[model samples]
Target chain A: MSLTIAIPKGRLGTQAIEMLKSAGVGESIDEKSRKLVFKDENRNLNFILLKNSDVITYVENGIADMGISGKDMIMENSADIYERYKMNIGRCKMSVAGIKGKRVFNDDTIIKVATKFPETAKKYFNGKGQKIKIIKLNGSIELAPILGLSDVIVDIVETGNTLKANGLEVFEDMYNISAMIISNKISYKFKRKEIKEIIELIRKEDTE
Target chain B: MNFLNIEDEMKYFQKMFLLRKEIENYLYEEGYLNIEPSIFEGYDEFTGINSRINRKSTVKLLDNNSEILILAPDITTGIVNKFLPRWEYGKKLKIFYYGKTYKHNGIGIKENREMGVEIIGEKNQNTDQYILSTAKQIISRYSNDFLLEIGNSKFLKGIMQSCSFNKEEYDNVMNLLYSKNRQDLKDYLSNLPFKNAMSTLLNILDLEGTFDEIKEQVEGLYLNELMQQGVEELSKIDNYMKNITDKVTYDLSMVSELSYYDGIIFRGYIKGSNKEIIKGGRYDSFTEQYGYKIPAIGFTVELDELIKVLDKEEQR
Candidate 1:
């Protein structure tokens, strides 16, 4: 019996494939091909390339037994999945950044924020007992504060270079994030041994 | 109301009503009593161990005395409270319930219709077997392919107690397991305050298979007395299930909500659905707190999810 694993197609895709190869997947996935699904019969595994955000949807519904995606996406989407491994790739931080700081928030004045992660931002602010309005943006979040559309933007920051280039600075750090391997709740039970073996192999390759 | 279409919505409600009738027939044939508790309840009445509702999740009204009256968040708690004191010793009560439970979700206050039966005043393998078989029978009516996953709350509690973890570490570990974060679980386990408690129990979390395979794996581990009892109970339940069906499986990381579901915990899933269509367990955790001291085992079929499964199959 072969187990299906979902890997996202983006910055972490190549690194994820490399990690899988090192973990003994036994077949090279043709990334350039027009196929979204690949089968490695020798290793008893099937791989599917999906959008970074859709990885959770596929895995959560059991279409794929396991998935590889960033912790930020997982937390933001609030996807119900088991984070199996950290993968140690695509490392970043979910933070609140703005143009060189203005004390972020000391008093509640209905601060308007912009980001792709509205739920996460709401949760963070709610935890601090501060109320804010979230103006969700798909991309170019840093420009939200610069163009006077919002007070600050909550997003993932890898290096200070992008924030500095856009004249913004990290104000508050929410949580550390990296690519994590996730599994469906039912799949974890039915495919325990097979999933564990692959996780073990990937664990070994991750440390190496 | 913002679902796909009116026809699909009507069909879903129609199927649920049909299923409810089926449930009523089965309960009546099995000599079960049907009861309906009040939809209006005091919020304090539902607070305790095994209480899945809290102040936050209740839609409440302020009375003239400034006391809050909550819309019923659960049906089982009310039924047990109303019947437990009047029950005669040595006699079992099989009761059935069909009602709408009101509770708050992240977005809004929602109501869900629950059709279920509770077997009270008995705490034995026979009762467990009866509940299991009945649950399987009802769920199989909606979906041809379904799986039953069983776990023991006492087993998990026993293992955690033996580990001697502080309350913070214990909550963190359970949350990780609840979220199925294996890597974080490993990271958290690696730095445990007690080294001896780490190795064996950590391995058990990943142990899942047929009851026989899992029994062999668990038997070889070093278990405390409480843990041993839990394992024995599960094995007995496993043996009882042999004559029924082969869809039974075991999982160690299956911890129930804190203060609820003391003994065996199980959930039923259809092959295609993301959520479990049926959830059943042995939870007498509230009886003692209510001063009744009666044991109870029951299951609820989430009609919405079941209808969704049937809808998907019909569309396909």
Candidate 2:
């Protein structure tokens, strides 16, 4: 039996494949190939490259037994999956960014926010008893506050350079995010031994 | 188009119905009768009686009398409402039902076909053993890849007796455990003033393995009076189950969403699917709602999900 693991396409996917190689469960792929699905060099594991959001969907539905996804994405989507291991490959923070100094508090005024992650933003504000209006945008979230379309933006901040160049500073860092190896609830049990072994390999690779 | 779309379209449903009949037949052979539950229930009565069911999920409608009614969201509640109140002493009720339960899934109303077996009015450990054995046997009969995951609700309830939480906080902790969100659970436990209690709860959260193996693992953790009693209660259930099936796996963190479950709780799963094929447990607390102290345990086989696997097996 083989385990099918989903990795989001792009940087995280490349990094996850590298980690899998180090764990002796995978090898480097032909980056130029048009294929989205392929078998690992070990031939005992299958890898499926998917969209950032689709990774969790695949894993949650058991199309892919396991997948590597970001904690932020996991929370936003909130699919029922087991977060097996934390891979420190894509370290970042889900933060509230706006024009530098004015900190938005839970006052009477309704704060307008823009982001790709509206559910997460709503949850964050609701936790603080802050009532806010959401203006969801697909990309270029910084433009919302810059154009005065919104008071602030909620987004993932990797190194603060993008926010700096766009003349926005993080208002509050809400959550720490990194790539996590997550497994379907049923898959975690059916393939317990194999999943445990792979997690062990990841754990050992993390320490080294 | 096959036969210009005139061919019988019930092919798929025919297969599913056959699968349902096989399950119903197995239970009937084991001395359970088919119970066709009513489709409608009094709305306020259903909601007030079954405290755990989300009120928003019940599809409410106006009757000829203009009183609000709800589509039956569960079979067990209806069964108890009928039998438990008028039971004869020393007589055990062996019942099973294949029915549709209606519920709103946030988007729209959905109906599920499930087969259930119930044994009520018995107050012995033997009843629990029979139910667990029957559940295990049924799952094994369907799929060789099935796993019967078991846990005791009193185990968590006992551990929680020491922690005083308001209604909101209690519900939050339950949600965290239900999702198995270990990261947040750790954060929630970090609020504890006592280190010993925190560590023990975390150890319990991570408890996995055989019943015996888990018992040994939790031996070193701090166990107060209630926690000890919880362990002793589950010990008997484990004793009843271990010899009958080797497919059992113990998980202490498994919390059933239904508040009625007050004893042994379990979910059955097979490979190649995340959806549970079987969900049954002891809902004795629910039985107490009828002003009687009847002991009850039962489970439902979700025929739809089982049919999915069956379809795959046939294809292969």
Candidate 3:
């Protein structure tokens, strides 16, 4: 029985595939193919490429023994899978941003925020003892504040280029986000040796 | 697809009842007396056990005397409060219970049906094996790929005591291990006083394999008196369990807030289930709360999770 690893399809997908290749786990992943499934028979590993947001779902369902995705997705989905290794790739930050001159929040006023990550936004505000109404958006989070749909937008900022282009400045940086390896709880229990080997291999490669 | 319509729901209920009966039959054969505790208990009496865990329970106010009442979050506490004093010591009492335990998980009020066996007055390696084997029998009858992962909390407790970590540092380390964040664990250990023990602790944290494999790894490490005793007891129990089932493994990182579990703790998982289908261990310190010193061991099988797994398996 080969261990199945779920890889998210997006910017992080290529980097994750490269990491695995360097770790000597998945060597047969096609760089340009529409097929969702890839297999390495010699290493007894299966790779399943899914949407970035759906990677945790596969790992949580036990359909995949392991997954590699950004920490932003982990927090957004409230994933309960075991985080095995911090790959230190795809480094970014989740932050609150608004137009440069906007002061949409006051001492006794409620703030309207927009983001694709409603759960993460809710947690951040609740931790600060502030009340907020979250306007969930799928994409172009920077447009929320510009179009008056929200007072501030809570989203991931890699280099702040999009925020700057939209005349927005960061109000507060919430959490550090990065790519990590997560494992299904049951798989970690049953396939301890194999999983440990893969994690150690990745950790070794990371050090070099 | 509306495949889970009325007929499927009814079938699920029927299967749940049948599963409950199988557990009851096992308890009966083992001479366990069926006892039902109250669904509601006094807050003051229950708070001793409830406060230990960070979860909240549904509470109602008694305006008459200003005393608070809580939906019973614990069955063992109620049983001990009502029965342990009258029962003679050194005489083992096997009590079986089946009821709904209420808990508010911050999302909503949830009720779960739990059927468990509590053995009072004996806590030894043999007693642990007896309860575990009985649980193994019931779980094996349901799923063939079930795995039983056992651990001794004292393994980590011994290490913590030796290191003398402050409360904050202890909690940080435990949380890292609980979340299985290996990278953070490595970084945190590098700056801590117990940096030398990092490799050994990480090995034990990642230790999960066959009985012999785990034993070999643990044996190669330098252990304190308490850790050595924990390892010896686990090995003895492993010897006993291997005779009954081969789906057993060891994981030293497993810990529970059920502080009452003084010795061995174990959890069961099927191939596809996200949660443990069964959890049990030796809780010798629990009886002391009732003003009696009695050794006890027991386990509860969550029927809801079992049914869910069976349903998923059927779908496939």
How well is each residue in A36-117 modelled by candidate 2, as lDDT tens digits? 8888656478888898889999999999988889888898987778877777688899999899876665558999999999
What's the candidate order when arranged by decreasing DockQ?
3, 1, 2
The true-structure Cα RMSD of candidate 1 reads 3.8
Candidate 1 backbone collisions, by pair: B50-B259
| Least well predicted 10-residue stretch by lDDT in candidate 1 chain B | B46-55
Docking class of 3: medium
Better of 1 and 2 by DockQ: 1
| Model 2 whole-model lDDT (C-alpha atoms) | 0.81
Clashing pairs in 3: none
A79 in model 2: Cα distance from truth in Å? 0.6
Query: Tens-digit lDDT track for model 1 on A2-99?
Result: 79999899779888888778777836687778889998988788999999999999998899999888898888887777787787788889988888
lDDT of 3 by residue, A6-122 (tens): 999887988878877887777778868888899999879899999988999999888999988788888887676888887768888999999997866544678899999999999
Instruction: Please provide TM-scores computed only on chain A for all of the candidate models, following their numbering.
Output: 0.96, 0.94, 0.96
True contacts kept of each: 0.65, 0.46, 0.73
Q: Pick the candidate with the highest DockQ.
A: 3
Candidate 1 C-alpha lDDT tens digits along B104-209: 8879989887777899888866898889898888887777778888887877778788788886788778878777677678778888776544665676666566
